[model samples]
Target: MSTWTSRAALAGAALALSACTEQETGAAAPREVVVARGAVLVAAPPGYCVDRTALRDAEEGSFALLASCASLDPNADGPSAQPAILTVTVSGRDPETTPPRAEALAAAAPEAVLATRQRGALALVHLGDGGDAVLPGGDPRHWRGATGTGGRVVALALYAPRESPLAGAAGGDLMAALAARIEARAPATVAAAPPQARSGDGLRATLARLFN
Candidate 1:
């Protein structure tokens, strides 16, 4: 009707639009953590080998990749006689309610020893019985642990004994690199899936594929 009234209405519409934009920006952005070719994320430790494709394929639920590193005895004068082991675990969103998954994982891999439990967010388990330690003069060990979140959890444990120096390092390094890649790619909000009977098999297969 009146030019002044028209101007006022336009101004009000602009203000409303601005408010809506602000609201949209304030909401947390959804992020996908899986590493793709040419995707720049965090760098892995020096000399560490990585298999990005295999890691992404193994990803289950919301759990994403994280940092991984291999512990080798730097003091050994000769070729390392023990294999280095790397363990990775993913937890669901609700740690308190994730026990069933953990139990399933424990059941699937009876050799994995229970290492420790931290509230609902995390649990630690060893994969191999104490036999050959990775660290020189240390106990032979291969272990892994997991924590819970709201979504899902995944844990990966790897070992490379000293006898097979190159293979061991390669395996350990690949796992560690994959962990790093996962951490860099996945979002923190993504929780690990509950442990299922196929969880171990899937994890082992994923690792084998990565190395193979």
Candidate 2:
């Protein structure tokens, strides 16, 4: 968990900033990206699409950057439940491949933890003031999660702009969906659905509730 975010921090921020700069980009809706010669499928949630320019892959691993199709390309149209940036990293399952440890990161950078929970094999963390250690200028409150699936461990994060609703609980739900979606795409696992509804709120409202 730490290794994934620690490595992608700078790259994630850059990808987000670049996407924001391109008011008009991407020629088509992206397809599921294959990684590691059929080891993993970078399946993005519905209404979202991968930013191919931000993709990094090797023979057995990959990092994918995703955002609303519209954000990637104005001409592309899709029902994005929340406007935010997302990242997914897939590596061969190993001893180091464990569930996300929000409390662990909190131990190292308590200021970055908003809330954290572990559910069975999956672990998730809500982050605030994580800009220093996570995504700078991102919604201080972002969401990250990790879990093992289909012989590999998947790590993913969701970053919203301050005013975006995804800064709320919906962010966690989204990351979980990303994890589940990846497992569903694995050759061994049965196919599952990818989707979401919507949320209506912003960072200030969330902060008030948290600090109040």
Candidate 3:
């Protein structure tokens, strides 16, 4: 859908797994599910939300979908007690959409994990990190995880308040659920095969080839 820029590259690198940044903006546009022709389905958990307008503003030409947990008090002070965020982005495998630097990225990140949607032949590559990892310019207090499959990458960042801590398994389960939902809803014609869940070397090579 759009060319991958440094931000996208960082996000792509996140597919391998940071920061906590408070959103200063007001509530986002009404939350709604987006179903793209490429058989991409993007939605958030019930009670959770996505700022479609803000997300679009963040990256105009990109196919990234960002979802956040609904907040009851937009004016609350300090770190939010909001639920985690889920971001799903798809990079078409065509030469124009896929970038050439993916190979080097894969080489450097050797700890990617492979996952799967519950109902399809697609395999997902995931990289997860707690608040300890540093995101390019994001909040280091938030937990982040990302998965890629069928030329698509889905990242979920769980943002809890300092008072509430989220478990790693929770993030994993959420990612899996989203993957399953995507596979179930994708169109039959969008049959792009996913990468195999192998070691980092193989996975990296596969991703480099698939994206580049």
* Order of quality (TM-score): 2, 3, 1
List lDDT for all candidates, in order: 0.32, 0.62, 0.37
* TM-score of each predicted structure versus truth: 0.34, 0.72, 0.45
Predicted structure with the largest lDDT when compared to the true one: 2
Q: What's model 2's TM-score? A: 0.72
Of 2 and 3, the candidate ahead on TM-score is 2
Q: For model 3, what is the C-alpha lDDT against the true structure? A: 0.37
On residues 130-183, what C-alpha lDDT tens digit does candidate 2 reach at each position?
643455555677776666655455666777877677887888888877776675
Which candidate order results from sorting by lDDT in descending order? Answer: 2, 3, 1
Indicate the residue-level lDDT of 132 in model 3. 29
Tens digit of lDDT per residue, candidate 3, span 1-212?
12112244345334322211343366433334543344455555445444443343211123333333434225433333235445554433322122223233323333342322221332333333333232343323433333444444433334332333332345545555555555323545445433333343333433333232
Over 139-205, each residue of candidate 1 has an lDDT whose tens digit, in order, gives: 3444443432233343444444444432323443354344344442344323232333453344334
Q: Pairing residues by index, what is the TM-score of model 1?
A: 0.34
